[model samples]
Target: MASPALALIVGTLFAQTARAATAWRFEPPSTSPTEQSGNYTGFSNDTINDTEVVEGKVFNRFVQIWLENTDFDDARTTPAWENLTSRGLLLSAFHGVTHPSEPNYLASIGGDFWGLQDDDYYHIPENISTVVDLLEDAGVSWATYQENMPTDHFYGSSYTSHNYLNASAEDYTFYVRKHNPLGVYDSVSQNKARQGRIRNFNDFANDIVNGSLSQWMFITPNMVNDAHDTTTDFAAAFIEYWLFPLLEDERFNDDGTIIVLSFDENETWDVQNHIYTLVLGNGLPEDLVGTTDDTFYTHFSLLSTVQANWGLKNLGRNDVNTTMSNVFDFVARETGFENTNVPEDARPLLNISGFAGPLNSESYIPFYAPDDLTAIGAGGQGVFVSDSLDTSVTYGSLGESTNLTSIDSQSPWIVVEDKSEAKVAVFAKEGNGAAPVTTNMLAAVSAAVIIAAAVYL
Candidate 1:
C-alpha cells in the first residue's frame, strides 16, 4: 500500500488536476503568484470562491459599477444614493481625471489617458500596457459587463435600442464603446481571446449563476441609466432596476466582494469635480458602515487599488504618480500601501478642459516613452515592461522622432476593410464612427492559465 503521506500529496494533486480538467471555463495562468509562493508552505490556495478569484488583500472580488456625469451634491440628494450612504463607505473626494467620458474610463484602467483630452476615437498602441496585462500575468480573472452590448467584443461606437431585457426606455442608446474602457486598447482588441471576454449582461448573468464570477468586474449601464442622458432621479431608478437586488445576491456580493458604485465624472465641472462614490458589499467592516472616507481618490486609484490588493504590476503611467494614484484607504491599509490626503484647496482643477495631452489638437505633443522600468508601483512591484517593447530605442530618440499628425488612432488596433493587406484580421468593422474596429468579434471560448510553481513547500 502507498504511504499515507504520499497518498495525501497524491490526493491533493489529483483534486487540482480534476478541477482544471473540469469545473472551469477559464484556467488561470502558470505565472499566478498565488499558485507560486502561497501555493506552497501554506494552506490551500485561498481561491476557494472561483477559478478567477486570486484572493486580494482585503477582498477576493472587486466589482466596479460606473455611472455617468452626476455631481456629488446632485447624486447624494437622490433617494437611492441617500439610502445607500447608510450601507457603504462613501468616498467624498473621488474625482474624474478629465472632462467628457472616454478618457476618464481609459484613465481608470490604463493609468494615463495618453494625453487624450477628448471623447473622440483613440487606440493606445499595443506597445502600451494596461492593468489587464498585469492581472493575467499574476493569474487573476477579470471581465467587463456592458448592459445592452449587442454581442461580446462588439466594436460599435454605440449599440442602439437592443434592450432584450426591456429594462430601459425604448429610445435610449443601449451601449456605447466609449464607456467600455478595455475595448479601446489595441492590446485588448487585437487579442482574439481578450476580445471575447468583453461580454454582455447575459454572460454576466450566466457567470453569476455558474459561480464563475471574475475576480475583477467593470459594469457599465446604458446611457440613460448611467445618467449621461438623464437626471439624478433617472439614474436612481436604474439603481433600483439594477443594483438593489444585486446587494442581496450572494453570487454577486459574497462576503469577500466589494462593489464600487461611482460616477465616471461630475456633471458640474466648475465645482471642484467631486463625484459620489459608495463602497458596498459584505467586505465592508461592520464598524465602518455608514462612514465617510475622506482619502483623496481619482479614477487612477481604481488601477492602484486593484494592483495593491492583488500585488500586481502597474502600467508605468500615472499609476506611479503618487499624487493621483493613491490606493483606496481600505485596500492600502490592508496591503501596507500608504494613501495621500489631498486637501480640497490643494486638489488639481480637473474641470478645466483642452490641451491636457498630445491628443489635445492645440497642445499636441507626440507620445513619450514613459520612463517606468525602475519606478515602483502601489503594490511595490516595478512597472510592467512589455515583452515586445522596442529594446533598441531610447526615450529621447522616440520623443524627438514622434509626429502627432502621422499617428492613426485605430491603425494597429482595427484591421482595415479592403485595406486588409495593411493589417491582420480576426474580423474588421466599425461602430458609431468609432475609428474602424472589429466587425468579426471573437467567439467566446475556453482558455487555460496554469503556472508552474512550487506546489509543495
Candidate 2:
C-alpha cells in the first residue's frame, strides 16, 4: 500500500505539471520566408512576397526579442521580459479583391469592391471612402507600411515593377491613391504634395523598433517581398520575421493585444473558394493552436471587425453580417481584456447547397471560362494564361492553338481546380490601337486538381 504522504505528494506534482502545461508563450517566427502556396492556379508567388516584405526588418533591434524570450510560466527566460503572447496584438492589413494587391488592400478595410478591379495600377478612379477614414474618425492611428511604395503616394506614376499583379488584376497600387484623396499630403519642405498615410515598408520596421507608432498598423510588402508575384513562402517568412519582435515586446506582454494574419482573397476563380485567416493572441485558448476556422467569410467580415474595434458605423449590406463574434472566445478571464466566448462545437456556415462537391467529382466541376474569368478580367483587355502543371488542362477559353499566348497571359480569371468545361470570347480591333483578340477555348481534362492546402500553424 502507498503511504498517505506519497499519495499527497503525487497529487501535488500532477497539479503542478498541469499548471505548467497550461502556461504557454507564442513568439513570432525568427525568419519568415516569402513562400507557402494557397488555393489558386499553379504556384503561390503573391503569398510569399507579401509575407517576407511586410515582416523583414533590421536584424539588430528585432534580435533582442528572441534573445530575451520567455515561456508563459511567469519564468524569466530573459531579464527584460519579452512575452509575445501577453503584450502584442497582431494587426495584419490584408489587401483584398483579387490576387492583385491594391484592390485587395482596399477591400480589406473598405468592405466593398471598388469600381476599378484587376491588379493594374493605371486608370485609378476616385470618390471612395476608405477604412482609414473610419480609423481616423475613431482616433485609432494607422499607417500603410508598403515594402516599395514609390513616391509614398499610391499613384506616384512610377510605372515600375513594384506592383504585385495576378493573372487577373495588375497594378494594384494606383487604385488606393485614386480612391482615397485623403492619403495625399502636401510637403511644405519640397513645396510639393506627397502621400499622407503611406510609408515605405522599411519605415514600418523602424517604427516597430522605435515604438513610435500606435496600437494599429497596416503593412504592405514590396512586389517580391510580400509575395505579390512570388510564392507563399515569401509571405510567410515576412510575417514570421515582423511578428517575432512584436510578440517579444515587453509592453505587449503586459497589455493584452491580438495579432491577425489573413489573405485578401483566394485565386481569381475557383478551387477552394475560401481564403486564409489566422489569429494570434495571449488570451486565445491554447487548444486553438494549429486549427482551421473554415467558416464562410467575405472580405467584408474583416471590415466589420475593424469597424467594431475602432467604433466605425456599419457600411450596410453584407458588411453587417461580417462580425467575428462566432469565431472568437469571449469568456472573461484573469487577463482584463474583452473576452470572445466562442463555443468549441460551433458549426461553420458552409454553403453546401451552393457548393456541389470536391474537385475530384465529375459533376462538381465549375465553369472555368466566361463566368469566372469575366468576373476577374472583365474591366480590362489583356490575355493571361495559368502555369498549370498539366498541359492538357485548360481554363476560361476554348481552342488551344488559336488563342494568343500573349493575350492568354493577360486573361483576368482565377484558376479553378474543378471545371466542367471551358468558355471563350473574341473582340474585334477598335480605333485606339486595340487589336482583334479571341479568347474562350476549351480543353478536356482527365482528373480534377485542388489548389488549396490545409495548413495549421
Total clashing pairs for each candidate = 10, 84
Q: Write the per-residue lDDT of candidate 1 for residues 52-138, one digit (tens) a residue.
A: 457778988889999998889988986767887888899888888888788889988887775566676555566667888998988
How large is the C-alpha RMSD of every model relative to the true structure? 18.8, 19.8
Find the 10 residues in a row with the least total lDDT in model 2: 59-68
Candidate 1 global lDDT: 0.68
- What lDDT does candidate 2 reach at residue 153? 40
The candidate maximizing lDDT is: 1
The local lDDT score (0 to 100) that residue 95 gets in candidate 1 is: 87
> Candidate 2, which segments miss by more than 4 Å at Cα?
1-102, 115-117, 122-127, 157-194, 251-254, 282-292, 321-457
Q: Alpha carbon lDDT of residue 26, candidate 1?
A: 18
